[model samples]
Target: MKTLNSYLSETVINMKPSGIRKFFDLAANMEGVISLGVGEPDFVTPWNVREACILSLEQGFTSYTANAGLYELREKISEYLFKRFDLQYDPAEEIIVTVGASQAIDIAFRSIINSGDEVLIIEPCFVSYAPLVTLAGGKPVSVSTFGEEEFKVNPEILEKYITSKTKAIMICTPNNPTGTVLSKKELEAVAQIAKRYDLLVVADEIYAELCYEDEYVSMPSIEGMKERTILISGFSKGFAMTGWRLGYIAADRVFARAMLKVHQYSIMCAPTMAQYAALEALENDEDVLYMRKSYQRRRNYIVQSLNEAGLFCHMPGGAFYAFPSIKSTGLSSEEFAERLLLEEKVAVVPGNVFGQSGEGYIRCSYASSMEQLQEAMKRIKRFVQSL
Candidate 1:
């Protein structure tokens, strides 16, 4: 009998499962588990946003939209970008509404990469980046970032990794699993390198709204970058609409055209009701502000608790994750996370799942409720003390 696995695409088979989701799946069904593993907002979609989707259905706006998405939603996205980040994008030609930020990223890779071409990925990064690059027929090259540098990309180290085959670089700000937000100065350094090398940038700014201390800057805001950067963002993180599956990509006409071709044939359009809901999300900022405040509070508490517990954790500038080093405990990230879950019923993702550089650390999301976070921290403190 032929093995069914033999017929699957080798590329798909070779890809690693997401480290964040692996721990999360275990945590989900466990009784009395305090999960700080999944990177999702604890808040539900705001009433008005949900009502808008309901209204759309009531009005019979259920047909597939234009391949790029509803023009109104695209216009709202355009306005939101310009208003928030000072970015200028053409709604008609540049933006494509996607199923989610995940899909937006996947299709962007499909748009620009060819077989054997390399795309530089910053680490520790979202687990999806490497596998998607490979699926798009591009090689995934990692440029390491360290905790000492606050995990910001160092231009010198990045330069050493670039080669003749490098075609693009993928970056996530308010980065997943590590709440590091690149500053304007940091981004400028990266922009200079990309400009000099003429590398296309795939900027995943899905967590843009969650930036703390400093305002988020779009990579395309940099000089000479607008034409070469494909910006991927979505309402999932900021608007707490993960199940809504609404995201979009903004790029130059040349790049947008290529992505549109793939999206057109592969995914005809984003959901009609979700598009209506997204418009409501865009027009209002109150729900976003409320959630950001909650996350910021949790972030501070988690970082302080981790450090006080004798785990070395740095304060993150954005997002809601607290990555603490467990190196002093003399345990690998996976071992520590597994033990913590079983012993304390507290769930955190092992950082090594993000990349090799993350091996000594674990990622703890602060997106849970204050009470849950407080309880998790208490359990973690006891667990560390036991070691």
Candidate 2:
């Protein structure tokens, strides 16, 4: 009569559930709750992408693709990368379509991390980074970025966290939670460190298409970085295909070959129809432009509204989230978020869930409709005033 729990993997057991989903689930069960918790886009998948999937199904192309994915899709990805980001990768040797960017990230970790290896994770970052590193038998060392610096990674600070055990560094730009996009100068600072230390970089560029200001800088495009950088991205954020679960990874063939073995065993291939849909998504940039413009408008309104409401939000440069300081209210992030939800019927994620640097802040996604965002702003102002 031994407990079944005794046989469980301690790694999985100790991992906390996603903080984003925690608020999302709570909001789901409540009535009339306006959730700004999740980072999903409000836009529907473009008609062309959806039609491609339908066409694929109609044509009975429903079999498993190569473990690496369809050759045509991989080729299109290579062209899209070069065209959009000035990145170059060999389609046959360096690209692997994944179930999602989440999977792309996981396999990248597994491919490079060894037991007791340390991967420096820049924070406040996506919640999955640390856990995936740990699950891959590596240590996740967090390098904190603060609001004072607008959350951009400072190379001096980043280098301090490295050690003999450090194997790689994980970065998400146009970062989640905090919408700071790293400029080329900022990236070059980091690139210098990586080269000096000979460290690998896992760059999560899922929000590349959503950058608000200047052109997006791809890590691989940094001088001398393509050979050591693993580029992870997908259709989830910019293309509004989250449910389709399509993503891909591009790297030097040496790195890609290692990650492919991990993807091959765990995922086999990304969904057949989804691959076709993503192919269509890459063929056109008009839908992406339309959605990015909408998000930029929302970003402006939300940042302005939050600051006026006394929450002190910095204008995010990319991605659809606004991380505003709730320290003014003298409430812990969790306390503020919980009470705000209960009192005002508005839901947002507590920033501390992302990393310790995020404490005293909260993340509000501006991806909802204008009507909903306007109302959410009003309620948030009222809630702040009440305190």
Candidate 3:
């Protein structure tokens, strides 16, 4: 019989297990463990949205959808993008419904990258990008963003990393872990660089609706960028519908066709009921506004609590996480996280899980209730004092 080890694809064999998942697995069975490590929203799908899904199922909408997604759902998404972000996309040709934003990222990489192409990723990024790039036979080149700079991508640093072999740059604003939202000026600078190099831009805007300050901006919305940018977003973050597994990519028709081909062979289409629910989410503005306000309240609470606990943290303008420097604890991020879980029954993700530059920091999600945030902060403070 053939050995099981030899049966795996080389890419699958070589990929490292997700760093976030490693600790999460351990935390799962531990009693009384209060976790702030997950990036998902704590809210359930809104009643109206859930009802839409149920209604679809009752109406026998369980069959597979069109490869590009249901035309009605795509139309709703197109209208939503234009109404919210002033961006226009031809739903029939320019959009592909995906399993989630995660799948969109994967399919986009597959569509554009060949073996050995380099993908420029901003550091302290979402954990999946590097491994996914590797799986697509692309090399991931990380450019570190410092907390001192409010985690904005530096144009000079980006310039230094560019080469002829670089196929694309993956940009995530209202970023995971750090919760930093890229400013309009910063995004324009990135656009200029992409324009100069003729590079494709993969802009992940899943957290667009969560911005606490200025309105969210799409890279493709900038002049000269729409054709070159592949925009990835979905209902997951904005609508508190993580379980819906519905996301869509808006790109040039050419790239969209390429991704849809891969998506056809792989996922076929996003879930039918979920797509109907997402259609409702896009048409409803108040649901988005309500969730945004709730997250903002939680954001303020966590930032203040961390500061009071003596962990210096930047106030996040978007997303649901607060990344705080744990240098005061005189421990590496892994050590700090491990000890916190062991001693205080509190769990947060170590920054090192994001990338090497995340060494002395830890990420806490404020998507939980205020009471949980308060308790976690108190436990953290006691743990720090003990250290």
Judging by TM-score against the true structure, name the best candidate: 2
Give per-residue CA lDDT, model 3, range 1-387, as digits (tens): 899998989888877888888779879979988899989999888888999999999999999999999999899988988988889999999999999999999999999999999999998999999998998889999989998887889999999999989989999988987999998899999999998998999999999989998888888889999999999999888889898898999999999999999999999888999999888877765777888899999999889888888899999989999999998889999999989998898989999989887879999998898888888888998998887
Candidate 1 lDDT over 1-387, as tens digits, reads 789998999888887777777788888878999888878888999999999999999999999999999999999999999999999999999999999999999999998888999999999999999999999999999989998888889889999999999999889998887889988888888899898999999999999999888778889998888998999999999899999999999999999999999999999999999999999999976989888888888888889999999999989988789999999999999999999999999999999999998989999988888889889989999999999
Q: Relative to the true structure, how large is the alpha-carbon lDDT of every model? A: 0.92, 0.94, 0.91
TM-score, one value per model: 0.98, 0.99, 0.98
Reference-based lDDT, residue 311, model 1: 93
Candidate 3 off by > 4 Å: none
Better of 1 and 2 by lDDT: 2
Which candidate leads in lDDT? 2
Residue 180 local lDDT, model 1 = 90
Q: Report the lDDT of model 2 for residue 48.
A: 89
The segments of candidate 2 whose C-alpha lies over 4 angstroms from its true place after superposition are none
Query: Which residue pairs in candidate 1 collide?
Result: none
TM-score between candidate 2 and the true structure: 0.99
